[model samples]
Each structure stands twice: as C-alpha cells, then as structure tokens.
Target: MNTILNFMKRNYKILVAILCLSVVFFAFNSNAKKDNDPERDKLLLELLTFVIEKGHYSPAAIDDAFSKGVYKDYIQALDPSKRFFLQSDIDEFSKYETRLDDDLLSKDLTFFNLTYDRLMLRMAEGKKVYKAILSKPFDYSIDENFNTDYDKAPYTATAAELKDRWRKQIKLSTLSSLTDRLKIQETKAKGTEETSEVKSDSLEMDLLDKAKSDKGVENSAPKTFEELEKETRVSAEKSLDEYFGFMNDLDKNDWFSVYINSITSRFDPHTNYFAPEEKERFDVSISGKLEGIGARLQKKNDYTEISDLISGGPAWRGKQLESGDLIMKVAQGNGEPVDVVGMRLDDVVKKIKGPKGSEVRLTVKKVDGTIKIISIIRDIVEIEETYAKSSVVEKNGFKYGVIYLPKFYIDFDDKGGRDAGKDIALEVERLKAANVDGIVLDVRDDGGGSLSTVVDIAGLFIQEGPIVQIKSAGRKKEVLYDRDKKIEWKGPLVIMVNSFSASASEILAAAIQDYKRGIIIGSKQTYGKGTVQNVIDLNQFVRNSAMGDMGALKTTTQKFYRINGGSTQLEGVRSDVVMPDRYAYLKMGERDVENAMPWDKIDAADYTIWNDNAKFKQAIANSKMRISQNDQFKLIEDNAKWIDSRSEDNTYSLNIDKFKTAQSSIEEKAKKYKPIYEYKNSLKFNSLPNEIDALNKDAILKEKRERWHESLAKDIYVEEALNVLDDLQSKAVTTKAMPVKIKKGKLAKS
Candidate 1:
C-alpha cells in the first residue's frame, strides 16, 4: 500500500504538469490570435464582399453559414428582391470578424450568444428592408423595375415586375451593346489618319440594314409599358395588396419569419423555422380536421389554386368547390371581401385556415370562366382526420394475411398508445397468428413518421444490421443498427408502395430489397425523399440573447442516407412489379420540385448480404408480361397519358365553346368503372353507412380487430408479389428472374 501510494504521488505530478501545459496552450491560443491578422480578416472581408456584392440570396443565408463556424460564406447574400447585396456593408461589418478557433472548440455558450446577437441584428435589418419593400409599394411589375441579375427563385421575385420576364433578360441587348468606333480616339503623340468617321448616307444605311439582321432572325419586341399596363395593372395592384397585407401581418400574424429567423440564428440550413400558427395548423392538417373551407391549396404563379378537396369536408359537402378553382378573394363570413390575386401563398393559406365550426366564404373563380361566392360551414372532417382502413384479399384459394401500414405515423401530441410503429407491428402479428400463407406491408402514400420508430419497425423484418446512416455538418456519422433480431413473420412477404412512399417507407423498402427478405411492388418509383431534416430551435442557437422571445421554426438541417452510399433521389427503389392506380396520373415526385437537394453518394460501409439472390430477374420478367396483358393496366396507362399531355404544356387556354364537348368526352370514359367503395358518412360508428361498420376506430381500439380477416386477391401489386414469392418458393426456379429495373429509354420515350 505504501509503495502504491508513492507511485500514485509521483504520477500525479506528471498529470498536473500535462494539465498545466494544456491550460497554457488553450489560453495562449485564445488570446494570442493576432488582433490584426489581416490574412484572416482579409479572407473574412473578401467572403463578406463576395456574399454581399456578388451573391443573389438573403443576408440570413450569410448569417446562417456564419453561425455554424463557417469562416467562409460560400453562398453569397442578396436582397429580398434578389438585387446583389452592397459590398461596402460587408467590408464595413468586419468589426465582428471572429476567428472562432478556441471558443467554438470549447463549445462556449458565450461565443455562440455573442454571434447570435450580432446576426440577429443583421437579420432584423434584412427583414426590415424586405418589409419596407412589401409595404412601401405593392410592386409586382417586372419588366422595367425587376433587376435581371438577381437570384430568380420562384418565391424571391418580390419586385414589381412583369411575370416571368426575367428569363428573357439574358440576351446580349440587356447584357452588353456592340459598337465599333475604336480608332476615332487617338493619342496626342500619335494621331493616326487611318480612320474616317463614317462613309456616306448610302453606306451608313447599308450598315444599319445589316445591323438590324444581326440582332437575330427571331427578333423579340419588348412590351410598351403604357400599352401593357392597362391589363397588367390589375394583377400588379392585387399582388401589391397581398404582399402589403403579408408584410404588415408578419409583425405578429406571420410567425414563419420568426421560425426561419430562429433556425438560421443557429447554423446555415441545419435548424428549423416554423410559424407559431403554422405549427398549430400543421398538427391539424395531419390530424385531418381544421376550420375554414376544406381544401388543399398551393401557389401556382401568382394565383392560389385548389389542389385537393377532402371528401366529406365542408368544401366537398358544399359541392360547389372544384379541384382547380382559383381563389381570387376570401371574406370572413359576410365581411368586406379582399382580392387574393398575386398574393403570397402562405398569406392566402393563413386567411383560409381557421377554427372549426366557423364560416368562411370564398370568392372563387371556377374552371369555366365564371366567378361565384361559395359559403361553407366548417366541421371536423372525420374522413380526413382518421387513418382507419381494413382490406380483404384472397390468394391461391387459401387466405393470405392482409396487413396495412397506413402510414409511418405517430401522434406525438398524444400520450398513451400513440405509437404507429407498434400499431402496425401488432397488426402484422395478428395477421401472422391467423396462420396465413403470406403477409403484405402496404406502405403506399406514406410520407414518413418518427425515425426512431422506423429503426424499431425495421427490426421486425430482417435479422439485426445497420438500418440507416445519419450524417451532419461535422462529418458525424450515426449508424442506426437494428440490434433487435426478433423475426415477426417468416412467411412469404410483400410490400406495396406507390409514388408517395417516402423517407421511412423507402428505408423499409430498401432494407427489404437489400436482404432479399420480401418482394417490393408499387409505382415505377417512390417519392425518392430519403433525406432527413433536423429542426433546430432558434432561441437555443443564440445563447443569452433574447432570441427565445421570437417564435420557433424548423429548417432542413441535415440529410440522411442508407447504409449503402446511394441516396434515393429522382429514382426511388424499383418495385418487384409495377401496379396501376389512379395516382399514376398525378405528376408528383421529388424530381418535380426546384431547389431540392440532389442525389449523391458517399463512402461505402460493410454490410452482410443474405442468400436470397436467386431468380429475381425471372420473377420480374414474369410479372411484366402479366401486367402488359392486364386490362386495368391499359386503363391506367390511358389516364396517365392524358395527365402527362396536360403537364408538358407551360400555358393553358380554355375554349368555353369546345370545353363543354371536351369535358363530357372525358367523363363518359370514367363512367365505365363503378365505384369501388360506398361512402360512409355519420358521427356514430354504427350509424356510419358501410359494410366496414365493424371495422371502426372504436372496434380496433378495443382490440376486437379479429372481426375481419382478408386476402390479397384483387390488388395488382400484391398479386404480383405473391406470384414472385411463389416462384421463389419453387426449387424449379434457377437463374435470376429478369431484373424489374426501370429502363430510362422506356420512360423517356413514354
């Protein structure tokens, strides 16, 4: 004991010496940074110049990168109208140029707080400028007023400008003018006599004639503002009014600004920004009930168009609201009507979204050139609210287990029994206990839910392995391994998906494909949204700053990927067999969106492959042949063709005379198919008009779910998957089934 104590005392001195050296190093590193390190400050100043002077973006973008300890702002800053930022301000702002070496390394909250306060002031100023622009004049004119060399994002075209004219401003006339009279000016020392001012009247006219042809064969004539103004002013005024309301409303009404400000306060795009009211509205949107007229609205150009109407909702119940109506104005239950034309989309949404049981009148413009007022009494849209469903399908004379994963969803707002993953798992177990031949996990149209639950749900399929990889700014890689090795169902498995199968759904589908554990069947590709987002609360990033006093927002912080390098982008997982459905006509996918993060690859990690790699190609071939001959597929194809034809056109015009004939021609074709299911509308479960009365939420909640057991006979995708499973079950199957991969040539030609 004495010897050990002596040894410890001797080593303690060494430890103390090491600790003292570290402290000295840290202290010197923090304070010894040359206050006038022009090299560091020079780069900072240059970055500031590049961002403010050359970039077309928001100052918040610069601040976003700055907060993340990014010494360099790669993305430049632009005004709200997207005019290039002033370089002088960036150069002058060097007073706050910080090294961020030791303080950030030590995770000092003070450092973060100081940065936050500085950025908040900058961001506040940026917002102030934007507000002024929106308020001072409701400018939506682009031709004379819109600057051409700015960031031309759809939402960022805030200047009063002619719609979409910025796209044409890249011509040589706008960029530079060509002229030749160089030799006219000569030095005093050497005055050359080689140049004549011009030849004669004939020669000048000839030159001018050639010059007219030089402009281009297809010459474009710029619009005369006085001539165009008569028609454009109405639109311009409406746009100005809308933006004016939004800018004024933003002080307290539009919390979205606060949320975005809060998120960018912390880091570049890592944090989240959500308006306070929007957050509440988000809950109601997924919960399937809200006030105002029930309709899914989206901004298209300068108009707010109806996207979808929830069946049985107030809008649908009113029966006058159509899918493509333009909401020109909205009046609060008999109040003074306000024009909504050329308005910011969110502002329109704010006016449209309200509490249930309220009255909201829409001055809507129908597809047929007519305007009318539609009054709707809001109610809790029950069908839109619940995810309750039950399906019965029979396969191969024997009953196959039918399980539906309605969504990768969980009501985080609710406390007990709020787990969607667990609910799906329970359903699967119930189906398996029925002694069924096969199991189907229907993931069609599921956007996503909790990531933690996704990992848990993945464990229910293949034996333990890494399910996903999460990467952040610091290159921190979190491998979410499925340690739970419990196999839920060993029977033949099928996963049904569609174009809407997204994040969590893709993870499951990818896992199932990776392990050769199940057959994937659905649309040509899923939504391909495999990336993840992190919601950073604004107040947390700002430290002691009073940022907490602001509202919250969630930003798209980081992206997620599979254990393998490739992320799902334009192409989602190819299903084992494609299925024909109504949504096939819908032109929706991640590829259709702008400014979406692209698909990329990273370093590959080790993964264990299972032994089920036989005959997948042959299975795919067989399924394709059968689908080609199917009647349902032909109908779906025809509809998709019509839908595609409409989407390809940039402009649409309706001939009211021929329009009636065209509308009826299409409706007659749709009447060939009878309704698949009758609508059940009632408050009480028993009173609900339907054969699926026993399959109500109350019955499922009470654990009386055994009342129904169905098969997978009718579903095209499920049937194909079963056929593939049967082929796999066969020992006769030898070579790989013909790969069910998408041929770009086929898609391109189509």
Candidate 2:
C-alpha cells in the first residue's frame, strides 16, 4: 500500500508540471500569432498613446486643439527652414490638421502617410533644384538679401518660386566662400609685400626677360576673381551634394521618430521618444563610453565620412583612420565586404560597432583622395576627455583647487562604472591633500545628469540635510536628504555656473546656496530645467502585442524644487555675483524651449544653514567693486553687448562687394576684443602631484592637460573666482560665527 501511494504522488507531480508547460505554450503561441497580425503597428500606437495620456506628469488633452498643435509642430519639424513643402502641399496637409485626433483614436495613419509622401516628393524636387542652382557660378553682384530667420518667411507658392528661393539660398552660401577666398588672397598679398625686396625698374625688365627665356612665369599667378568664383561654385556644389545625400538616407523610421516626438513634445520639451538605436546613442553620450571603432561618422555625398576619432579609441590607437576619411565598405573578420556607400549613417555605424575584440576592416578614402583598406580591432572607448578634472591654481600665495565637472555622468546598468559623486569625492580628497585654501566647482555648460549623483555630491559640502524636493503628479512630495553627517571639505567654496548649467548642476548650486555652504558666481542665472524624466521600455507595457522593440518613451514624471520652496523651472538659480558673458542676452535657457512647464513653489524642506561666518554680503560687495574696476571685465561686458547686437541683425547682403565690406567691418570692429583672448593672468595652474606621472605617460592626455592649463591661465572668470575665494578666506579669519537661523523651514541668515 505504501508503494502504491508513492506512485500516485509521483504521477500527480508530473501532471502538474505538464499543465504548467501547456499554459506557457498556449501563451507563447498566442503572442506569436499577434506578432504576425497585420494590426500590430496599430495596437502599438494605441498602447503608446495610452501610456502618454496616463503616465505623463502634465499630460495635455488629446483633442482637436492638441491635434492641431501636433500638426503644426510636426510640419515645422519636417521643414523648419521653410526649404520644402510648397503652399499647395501645406494646403493638402491642412485638410487633416483637425482630424489627427480621430485618426489616433482609430489607430489610422492616413495623415502621416499623406504628409510623408508629399515631403518625399518635395525633397526629390529640392535635390534637383539645389543641384541645378549650384551647377553654375552665382552672380554675387546682384543686390539681393536673404533673411535667415525662417519664421518670418513664407512658403513658396509655385515650383518657379521655389527654384528662385533655392537660387538665393545657394547664392548666399557661395558668397561666404567667395568672401573667405578673397580674404585669404589679400592676406597672402600682404605677406608677400612685407617680405619681398624692393623691385627696381631695370630688375623688372630683367625678370621678364628671364621668365621669357625659361618659357614660363617664375611664380604661379594669384587666383583671379572668375577663378575664385568657379572654385567657390565647385565647393558649394559638393556641399549641397552631401546635404542632399544625407536627406536621401532618411528612412521611414527617421520620419516616424520626428512625428512621434512631436506628439510627446506636447506634454513638455523634456519628454521625448527614443528609438532603439537612439536609446543606445543616448546611453553612450551619458556614460561617455561605447564599444565600437571609436570614430564619429557623418554622411557626405553618398559616403560615410569620419568626422572625428575619439581620443584613445580603437581607430585613434590604430593610427590609420583620420577625420575626413570616407568609409566606403565594411567587412567582418575577412568576410565579404559590404558596400556602405549611400547607406544611412546609423546603419553604417551599426555595421562598424561590434563586440569588443572583434575585427572589422574598412575600405576608406583618405582626405587626399587615396583609397586604402584598414583593419581595426574594436574596444571599449572611454571618452574621459570630458570627465571631471581638477587643477591647483596659486593666487595671492594661496593655492585654490578648481574642479571642472562637464557633466554628472553615470552608467545606470553598470554597477562598477564611474559615478560622479564618488569621483568628485576622490577629487576633493586629492585637493585636500594639496592643502588648497579653497575650491571652485565649475559647472559651466554642464547640462546635468543622474539626480542621485547630484545629491551625493551635494552631501559632500555640508552636514546631513535635505538636498532637494521632488514632487510627482498626484503624489506626495518627497525630500531627498544627505543622511551622512560627515563633511568632505570645510574650506571656502564657490560654485561657478552659466546659462548652460542645468538640472543636476542647478540642484547642487541651489542647495549649496540655500544652505549658505558656498557662494555662487558666474552668469546671471542657470539653465532652468527642474523636471525629472524616466525612460520607460514600451515592450513591458504590451502583454501579447507582436510589435518588435517599440523603443523607449522618455517622459517627465516629476518636478524638482529647491529646498527653499522655489522651483528652478523658468526662474533658475540666480548667481550671488552676476557677471556679463556671451550668453547674457541670449534666449538659450528653459524659457526658450516650447511647451516648457511653468514654475511654481512648494513647501520648503527642513534644513540648517552653515554658520561659519557672517561676512557673505561684504564678500559679494568686494567682488562687485573689483569687477567694476577690472578692465578685462569691462571689455567682457562690452563684448557681450556687441554679440547681442550682431545676433539681432539677421539679414545678410548677397552682393559680393557689400558682403565683403560687412565682413571686413565686423573683423575690424572685433580687433578691439583681441586683448580679451590674449589676456593672461599671473596665476599658475598645475595638476595634482599624484596624477602628474600618469599624465606624462599618456602623450594625448599630457597635451590635453597642457591645453587646459593654458586656458586656465587666460580665463578671466577663473581669475575672478580665485579672487572671490581669497576674499572669502580673508573674511573667515576676522568675522565671528553667527547663529544659524531658520525661516519658514528654510535656512535663513540673521
């Protein structure tokens, strides 16, 4: 009876396993059938639309108005310069401008198909028009003007009008070349006159006789106006050919990306759709590393041209590839070479990027027009060129460390990869070992990265406190705190920001300012980008749908606020010591972006103010006084005004003589600002002692460090920042400590 019981139990277990397998098999079959269904794209579209509507933080209602917005944005994106799609084409597309919402509901793409087909037709016509216009030399003597600001321009009404537009556009481009050539010739003539011996009257005749005896002129004649014009026309033709070739490489997926992004953009500028390949590119950019040939490729006249070789990458190490070399074909490990000419750049990049240690051979056309085949073994290229680096600057007998963090970079999937917080901590430790009096954290042009990393970095400068406040739609506000009680550096600290410093950069700068831990300096304000985004994998949303890799949707799911209850959306963090710079009057911040979220305030988080000294106001006043007296800064302010004036003048003269006169006038006026570029401070900058040996070992790295040091020696901003640091240090020695005050749950000064 016991043996009979054991047999029954074993059979029952087998039966359960069989049932489970059957269920999985049925589910797999169902998914497979769905994948083969013709309505897969429609289902995927529905899923995407639903996700955006349900998941976006500030989702816009998809009605007739929203559809109209999508239509206008999409059409503008396709032809932003107004170079394609005539009035007739726009009229044809306008018919469905209000019907897009209905089509989205039904999962139909009639509007997209119609607009895409018309764009293709117009693009084909544009290719021929530009080529025909560039085939012959342009008459630059015509007194015509081309307004570069496309918004004020109107669409062409007929083919003849479009052709005339193309002619003017091509003429404007050719005029630039003509002006450049003329300048070069004038420069050469000036050099010749400066070096040449005085020609005697008899010597001139003797030279002519000698030339006749030799049957040729001794020196090559300078290029004439007509010859220069022909050369300019040739160059313009080649450039246009490359431009049209790149346009031809745009496939359905490319146009679809633009279309889908237009839809996502209605929510916010930060929200975007990243196709599979685009996602990979985004990862590479953030991590600053990729496993590939390590060359930047660009489309040029039916060829994939190498634009740049990444320092220390496989191609750069190989020493055979170079910028301007055209990649004609690619082969894998002695396999048959596949012609990549006329292929899309992304597709060619895929063929070249492979697993590390794999061999790829490329047939390349060198810049000098020589063709050669070269093999390269792919490797992981680390773009350490833009990573955070620190240097010591000696000013007023005190050494100040300057840490330039280009971005807050982090690899999400690689646990062992580089982290900005950890790297910055290590840099701080190095600076401390050097016994620097103060530190200047430069986040100029840093577009920001990983939020967690910013919080970690901000924690280094202060004791435990709330770093930032995050609030999502329909969710409670959460305060991110630095739980750690240890401080990394307690010396005088200053953060330098600019209009390009954004997101994570603003977070650290704002937190440091709020806690009174450091003084902020540089531009009038930082880039206002307080939104948080997350890239969602679309495949995870579909259970049984057969759409292959529907890409990821980067949606802004939350908004961040300063610890002091202020949002950095439109009103970014204002610098305590504002300085005039090139972007001072430029519209280049979050306010410049379309569909940007409005700024608002939230409840301030609890925090403690640093109470080291109470001379912050005096320090800022001293800095301002110095800036007002400094001639370099005065020049900078004037230069900023000049740049703003130039940016406002968009109209250009097509006449060659007038164009040259304008160019010459600008160059002459710019001569006064030459001193700005030539100014050199007395400060001496050096790498940390521990890093000197490693830098010397790497030639490329050594050159980069040398260039960086040279730039620092000439940077007026760094000079001023060091002065501020010195002032802060001087005041700390004499000023008494003040009691920490809290106002409305925020750090306040008494």
Candidate 3:
C-alpha cells in the first residue's frame, strides 16, 4: 500500500496534467468566438449539451448533425416562424461571422423532438384547461377581468345548448390547427380546376333580402353557414374597434406561431413571422399584377370597407364608390349578386376582383344610407398613381406647381436595375420644367417603399446632406448621407400629407420639413411606421427539403429614421396645413396601436436652411380669401353634407316608412346638388362593363370636374398651401396646422 501510494504520488502531477489537457481540448473543440459575443457562445454550448442528451432521434439519424445543422435549429427556435432560417438563406447568413441565428441553431435531435413533443402536450393541456374553465361557469364580469381572471372566476360558454356550440367552436378552432402541426396549406388540389362551378342559388342574393328585413340577422338567427360566417366576421371586427385586442386569425394557426413570435420579439421588434399567403402575396402585390378590383380594400370584421380608392381605378372611375362604403354583394356581369356580408375579407375580395377590364358589380351600402349597384370595370391601375403626378394649381393669385406624391414608389424587381430615385428625379424635372412658381407635393395615403428611392427623393429637394440613419442590432447608428450636390427641384415647396403617409413618405416629409425646405400640411400625424421588412421566400431556402416551398415572408429587419433619430412607428408625420375630413370623428393616425414603437427624437444633424419662405405664406393667405369665398369650395362643402346624409350607416331603419323617407331625402339632395349631369347617370351596381359608361354623362362630367378643379384652385386647404408656398418664396411665415385623420393607422396594418 505504501509502495502504491508512493507511485501514485509520484505520477499525481502527470495525471493532473493529463486531466487538464483533456479539459482544454474539449473546450477548444467547442469554443465559439469572443471578439463580439462570448456569453452567446457559452449558452450555445450548454444548449448543445442539453439537446444531445434527450433530443428525439429521427429515423434518418440527426444525432450528430454538422454544426451548421445545429445552428439551424437554434435559428428556428429563435424565429420558428421559419423567417430567417431558409435553406438558401443559410448560405447568405453563413457569410456573416457571428450570425444572429447562432443562438437559435440546434445541435441535436433531442432538442427538436423533445420541444415538439412538449409543445404538443402543452397545447393539448391548454385546450383542456380552456375547455374545463369555459364549461364550469358563466359570468358577465368577463370583460372587466378577462386579463387577470382566467382562474377562480372564469367566464363560461356553457349553457346546455351553448355547450354543444362551444364544443363545435372549439373543435373547429382549436383542432383545425391541430389537424396539422403548423398552419400550412393542407391541399394543393393537384392543379387548378379549368372551370369552377358557380351555383345559380346565389348566396349573396338571399342574404341581401334578409338584411333589408327587420332584426337584421340576429345572434340566434346565425344558424346557416352564411349567418355564422357573418357573426364570426362581426366578432373579428369588434376587436378592431376601441382598443385592438386578440390575435389575428392568421397568427392563431397553431401555438408555435404565437410562441416563436414572442421569443424573437425579445431580441428585437423587427423580426417576425409570415404565413403562406403573406409570403405569396408579398411578391404578387408589389409586382402589381395580381387580380384585384384596383382599389385599396381592408377587412374590418364582416365588413370589408374601402380603405383608399386606388386613384383612377375602375372604382374611382365609376365615381360612385367612396371610402367607408361596405361591400354587400358581388356579382359577375348581369348575374345575381352574392351577399358576401359574412364571408372572409380575402374571399370577398377574390369574388369582387378579376382580370383587368372585366366587370364586377358590388352591391354597396354607402355610408350615407343608400344601397346602390355600383358596377366597376376592373382595370390594371397604372403605376403612375404610386408616383408623383404634376398639376398646376393657382391658389388665390399665386400659380403654384402641384405634385401629388401618392406614395414612396419602389420597384423591387428593379433593385438590381434602375432605382426609383432616378424616376423621382425625372418627375422633379417635369415639375421644374413646368416652372409654375412654387410646388405643392400632396402625399395623402403614401405608405413608402425602397430605401434608395427615399434617399434619392430627399436629395432631389436638398442640395445634399444626411437623408437618414440606420442603427443595426447592438451597433452604433450609421448615417446614410446624400453627398451628391445636385438639386432636381429646389423651388419653394409645400408638402401635403394625410394621416396615412408613412415610412419613406414620413422620411421625405420630415426631412423636407426639418430642413425648412417645405411646409407639411394635412393630417394631425402620419402612419408612423419607420421600419423596414425584407422579403424572404422560405421555399427558396427549403426548395430541396421535405416542405418544398412553404411560401414567402416579409420580415421586419430594421427601423429607419431621419438623420436625427425619430422613429415614426406609432406617431405618424404631422401636416403643415389643416383640412377638415369626415373621418376625424374616428380615432385616427398612429399612437393608436398597442405597444407600437415609441416616438423619440435623437441628436439633430447639421444642415443649412434657405431663409426664403415668407413669400409662400403671403401667397397662401391671399389664396385663402378666394378659396373661402369661392363658389366651388362652397359647393364641395355642401356636397360633403349632402353626401354624408346619403352614406349614413346602420341608421337605415328597414321600416317601410323610414325607407321611403330616406329615399326621398336622398333624391332631394341629389336634385338640389345643382349639377344637372349628376342625376343623368344613375349609379347602380351593374355587373355589365359596357353599361358603366352610362353612369357618367361624359361631356357634362368633364365640364363639371373642370369647373370643380377650377373651384379647387380656390380650395381653403389647397389654396392655403399654395399661398404658403408663395409666401415662402416671398419670405413669409405661416404657422403649421393639422389635416384629416385616417383611422387605419390606429390598428394593426396586418
């Protein structure tokens, strides 16, 4: 024993050395870099060890997949929406030294299998708990304590009759997603059907006859598919009102979407998920080739209301279509209309949308209480609407150049080609060539596109300076400056914007306003979304994998701001000239979204301001007089009231006496409008395109519009803006004011 102990002691130093060496070797083998992030590497190692021990094994055997494979798992865990971890995307992400996805990549099968299993188990448990709670009690206090009262005093969906309904409802919703692990397309139908059958039993026609009756589709009455559909839609829309609550139907496909979305959001607000349709439509929409009614429509529950009229579109051309009108029925030309009141918004849109020049008639319940057949010829609206259109407006005595910048235009297909900035430069050249005193840039509902175009547009007005700044994750903000000393159109500028102007539009408007280059007039604030999203087609990444192509994803990448920091997420841009709009009664603009990116001002950049804006103000004040007294402005205001009465919503009492009284009031207003031609063309929802022309008495219409535009020259807001521009040119001072508020900004743009 002594001899053995002596030998052991003698070799103890060597043995310890060997043990230390082994430890060092393993550490080196698993060492992640420390130049940027050391803590991340340590967590990754721990996760690797944890995963290898208990992760489920696939028949294919991913026990010791490559570190690259492991990395993918971590990425997916971080963003399970499958946003960044595309197979093709891996190649690009791999190029980065320390990918953000490293923490998300998984090293073993145990992690994936175990997590998936646990996830399913948890989901089942959740449903069980929800079912149990819902079955146990009924209370009216649910609205007050739903946020905190899941336990103890839960609200129940459980009357004997309600129990069966609750079960079915839970079955469809909770189980619809469970039938598949994720929200993926269940069937591709092999191929498209050459001819789809439309039954002569019109779903739309029957609903309309019912709607015009008393007690308009009550709760107990929602027995049919259509009725239930309407109720579901109504429920979905209810969340949109007051304070936005509840997850969107798309996000509720499965538990994973909810889980992944929350997890990744902790790291940064930009990253998010994309459903299959979101990905598909991402390309189709921007490409501008998708079959749509050529109008900007939005779903607000069972009601799909017109968000914006795609200017010069068939709906706009039909002239009867107005924002806030609810589409009730859809019919192909001369066919009986289908009441799509309770249908999915997208499905209804599909029903209404078709190939360009084809006719789709909408049974529109105008906000003013009139139900009319407004037929429109769906035409491919030109991209010009998304660009800057130049017009010469003489407000009061000053003839100012008016350029309507609909949105910050960008063509992604041309990213590798021509930049939209150059196009804007050309448009500016047109305005400059027109040489009409000062300029008024009207950007009412422009939502922004293309960073390069935004930068380029800003540069066109200013000689050159920092247009914007981008701050990457945990990195110092880098300024993107316009060093080019070229000015496309540097005349006194007046920028007209509404609550809907956002992103690139906000950047441009803010920059111009900040630089003292122009005045912004319109809404109280703009849609303050100053973030950027990158289109990620997951199919590109997983093309060779089992899923083939999952679809596309437009993931938020980063927030953009003026050279001086100010993210316009919840707070949109404020206008310089105020105008009254009927929509103001509703909660409008940003700051309405829950947890929208907060507004903060950063350090201001240095720039030179030309002190020559007095004349623009002088001209504006002078124009206001003409506008205030102008016959056209008076007529327009009167028409707004007259139109408002006709478009009155829900107040339509289906009572015979009320219906006739309302009809008489509508006819009276239509006659008193003073324009003889307005009455000649009766706007009915005709499915026939050839018949649409009769709605407008062309020559008289042109004469009236020209007269209207001439009157518009004297419009209080337009005239004031032009006068402001003239005053600026003459070196005048006009205090800024607000304009109309657009309500969509208050809710999730999803």
lDDT of 2 by residue, 1-750 (tens): 000001123333443344334333222224543222335556545656766665567888789998898899999999998888899889888998898888888878788778888899889888888878877777887898888888878998999988888888888877876776666556556766521222123423343355445767545456688987886677677767767777777777678778878888888888788877888877776777889888888876677889888778999888899898999999998999999988888889999999999999999999989999999999998888657899998878898999999888877778688878888999999999999999999999898878888888999999788998888787788888899999999889999999989988999999999988898999999989988877666666445545466677777767889999999998889999988796698788898887899999998887778877465777889999998999888998999889988886888999988987887788778878878878999888999998899787677788889999999999989888988888888633455466576666744676
* Ten contiguous residues minimizing lDDT sum, candidate 2: 1-10
Question: Stretches of candidate 1 above 4 Å error?
Answer: 1-252, 255-272, 281-392, 411-417, 539-549, 580-587, 612-618, 649-656, 661-750
lDDT of 3 by residue, 420-468 (tens): 4665576567656655667777666776666666777788887777777
Candidate number with the higher lDDT (1 or 3): 1
Evaluate candidate 1 by giving its C-alpha RMSD to the native, one decimal: 19.8
Per-residue lDDT, model 2, residue 607, is 78
User: Which lDDT value does model 2 have at 193?
Assistant: 55
Which stretches in model 3 have alpha-carbon errors above 4 Å? 1-156, 159-272, 287-384, 395-398, 415-420, 540-543, 580-588, 614-716, 729-750
* TM-scores for all predictions: 0.49, 0.88, 0.47
How close to the true structure is residue 74 of candidate 2, measured as C-alpha lDDT?
A: 97
**Alpha carbon lDDT at 80, candidate 3:** 44
lDDT of 1 at 375: 83
